[model samples]
Target: MLELACISKTFNPGTVNEKKALSGVALRLEKGDFVTIVGSNGAGKSTLFNAIAGAFYVDEGAIRLAGEDITFKPEYKRSREIGRLFQDPMRGTAPHMTIEENLALAYLRTAKNQNAFFSRTSKAEKQFFRDRLALLDMGLEDRMKQPVGLLSGGQRQALTLLMATLVPPKLLLLDEHTAALDPSTAEKVLGLTREIVAEHHITTMMVTHNMKNALELGNRTLMMDSGRVVLDIGGEERKGLTVEDLLKRFKAGAGRELDNDRILPSE
Candidate 1:
């Protein structure tokens, strides 16, 4: 459902501090493919995700979603086809809005009538929101009237996930969505991620620093280094691999062991 071809991005180009964030990065995803990406700092993992999300224009290459070339499309223009969850728990939702209000905004994405206010929830819409929230089983339905600011980190991220998938975009970009949560909560959120992705059959790319998570979730695993994809493994091969095996591959591909402290396996 998504394809990136020979994408490259450079910051402060032609200057002494010129840093290439992405170098000829190419990737393709089928309709329901879930991909987990891992890399050390400055490996271009997040850069690639941001590029696909249209956060900024790439210096070279093309981005296509479901056969539409969106390389030159503005960020807002691509929002209809993409859903993103950032690393920060606070980044995805409006704190002052009630839980239901936030969901109302997301539901608006698929609305045929532009004049309608998502917050003006009809009985039918309310029921729909309630049914969706029930899937989280987080008692969010009861707290629909509560402001999102009052929610815990995990709750906010879970709500963000719900928002991202509400419309079933052509591609979902998860940039360390569970990074800021506590261990137990992160686990719960990860489980929710798997459930939601499977149910919706949405194409997804998840960037994570945790090796175990990179290996455990998603249909494919990609390792990046120095602004390029150094390794890609998936399906039965990835399923049979261990953390140590991934480390070995990283070392072989990058000619050095991954040294990022955050890339270590979670105990």
Candidate 2:
């Protein structure tokens, strides 16, 4: 569903504080592929995501999604085809807006309707939002009029997840969507993520710090380092792999052990 060819990106080029964030990184994902990425800090995990999300143009690369070239597409334009969620629960939402309002904006924006910005939600659309929110099992359907700011961290994150997939974009990028919450809440959000993705068969890429969750949650796992993808494992090979096995593989591929000592076995 997505393809990247020779993707390379650098920051502050030709300066004292220069850093290459991505180096000839190439990857491909088929439809409904759930890809989980784990890497130590400065490994270009987020940069790869930003590159795909059109946060910045890659120095040299071509990005194609569902057979369309979006290499130079503006971030706003890509939003129609790509759905993204960040570590911070507050990032994707308008804190002062009611839950229903937030859902409406996301719905209209991706609906690709020319009248999206000016259109008002009909009673039927409001009902649709309520039904979708109800699927979160968070009591948000009844609280549609409540400001998003009133929700707890997990609740808002769940709401954000709902908004992102309300229309099932061609691709979904999750940048540690649950990393900011407590373990229990994080687990709940992760469960919601699994269900939503499966329901729509959304092709997804999730960047996570927990090695255990990385291995357990997705169909494929990618290990990245020094701005390049060092390892990609999936299917039968991935089913037999454990966290320690993954670590050893990373060491072999990256020529160095992963640097993050605080990486735990579980979320």
| lDDT (Cα atoms) of all candidates against the true structure | 0.90, 0.92
Top-lDDT structure, candidate number: 2
Q: After aligning candidate 2 to the native by TM-score, how far in Å is the CA of 195 from where it should be? A: 0.5
**Inter-residue clash pairs, candidate 1:** none
Of candidate 1, the 10-residue stretch with the lowest lDDT total is 110-119
Supply candidate 1's per-residue lDDT for 206: 93
In candidate 2, stretches whose alpha carbon ends up further than 4 angstroms from where it belongs are: none
For residues 1-267, what per-residue lDDT tens digits would candidate 1 score against the true structure? 888899999999999999999999888888999999999988988888888888899999999999999999989778878999998999889999999899989878767687888757799988888999999989999999999999999999999999999878888999999888998999899999999999989899999988888888888999999999999999889999999999999899999989998875755
Error of 2 at 147 (Å): 0.9
Candidate 1: regions farther than 4 A off: none
Global Cα lDDT for candidate 1? 0.90
Model 2 pairs in collision: none
Best model number under TM-score:
2
Q: TM-score for model 2?
A: 0.98
Q: All candidates: CA RMSD in angstroms?
A: 1.2, 1.1
